[model samples]
Target: MTEAIASEAASNPGMQMKYKIVFLGDQSVGKTSIILRFTSDSFDVKYQATIGIDFLTKTVYVDDKMVRLQLWDTAGQERFRSLIPSYINDSQVGVVCYDITSRQSFENVKSWVEQARQ
Candidate 1:
């Protein structure tokens, strides 16, 4: 399911384009936190597992062009793995996050990449 968030128009006077960015990773790997940091510049210390999916939008200027990024935060639990392929198929960018302190999370990067590719 797609969740909509308020989006601001880009400062550039030309036509704006929308890009979909999806974040993927193992549970507790900070996927939501990273997107929150980039979109709101705030981080929550509390840990919360995301449900199926959560979405947010942020407008950014790239090369003096206005771009609207549709950020999709996905659940990392194995139970939700089946829902990821549809999101990946629709995304223009996929960010795979992992906990720096967890060796297991690091090792799972390949698996995440393969999922995103599929």
Candidate 2:
């Protein structure tokens, strides 16, 4: 993720900077999996639905600056969709995840992207 966001964090090494990266997608689409893989270098095979939103932080060097990534693992259930916009309001990046095997999940990517756009 460091290399991935390095260009976006092009700033001087004066002080640590923070960024909010919100993950948005339908249920069981591996939104959390991406975050876990980036922050811990590990993956979980079991499907554990995220309740509400899980906040995780990781710091790395980006363009000689200490960049703090505030990874937001958002709940993908329809019941929690209402809460997404509040968090998305200030996000630096919104990653829309989808399962390649699920057609509906892929279809919903537009709606998620639309939501992030707003």
Candidate 3:
């Protein structure tokens, strides 16, 4: 269940670590944008709703240890709510994002967090 990437380097060879991070929020809350920005350092102005779920992996060095981060982006549509439980079951971290300009989206954070907790 753990998605890990091993690193072979002179300093720290054959070290493997993985972390699953799930993003949860309402539609158009910029979850995708946040992941894209961190993983690729780029953002697209065009808005595309995530269908069901999307995943991306990025490897980074944390305190001289190589760690692979698996980012899970979940759809915010009401219909896709059922699919979230499976994703949350194995996730090590859950991030709930909301648009700062939208009060409704901000208010939904509590529900999203509760869902992730379950």
Candidate 4:
């Protein structure tokens, strides 16, 4: 896990900067999977939808300093949009992802980004 962190930092040093992270993307785009991988080092193949929002926190050691990431996994469904704005407040970083095989999902990432901006 530390190796993964090192490799990630090597590729994008910006992530090392302190951030309150939020994951935003279309449904079933592996946003939750990514968080679970980072947080729990485990993955499940079964698809389960998020209700409104899920929250997790992990502290990464960066150059003798502890950088904390408050990660929020928001629901990708339209019905959950009303619940998203609350999660966006105080967020310092946002990750938007979409599955490669889903063109519609990919196209809708813009709206998700826009919603976050609001």
Pick the TM-score winner: 2
TM-score of 1: 0.86
As for TM-score, the candidate ahead, 2 or 3, is 2
lDDT digits (tens) for residues 17-116 of candidate 1: 6889999999999999999999999999999999999999998776566678999999999999999999899787899999999999999999999999
Task: Point out the worst 10-residue segment of candidate 4 by lDDT.
Answer: 1-10
Which 10-residue span in candidate 3 carries the lowest summed lDDT? 1-10
lDDT (10s digit) by residue, model 3, range 1-118: 3223322333456667678899999999999999999999999999999999999999987556678889999999999999999999998789999999999999999999999988
TM-score of every model versus the real structure: 0.86, 0.89, 0.87, 0.82
Evaluated at residue 27, the lDDT of candidate 2 is 93
By lDDT, the candidates rank as 3, 2, 1, 4
lDDT computed for candidate 2: 0.89
After superposition, candidate 1 runs with Cα above 4 Å error: 1-13
Please give, for residues 1-118, the per-residue lDDT of candidate 2 as tens digits: 6655665556433656788999999999998989999999999898889999998999877667778889999999999989999999998888999999999999999999999998
Poorly placed runs, candidate 2 (over 4 Å): 1-12
Sorted by TM-score (best first), the order is 2, 3, 1, 4
Cα deviation of 77 in candidate 4 (Å)?
0.8
Candidate 4, superposed: residue stretches over 4 Å from native? 1-18
lDDT for every model?
0.86, 0.89, 0.89, 0.82
- Clash statistics: count for each candidate: 0, 0, 0, 0
Model 3 bad stretches (over 4 Å): 1-14
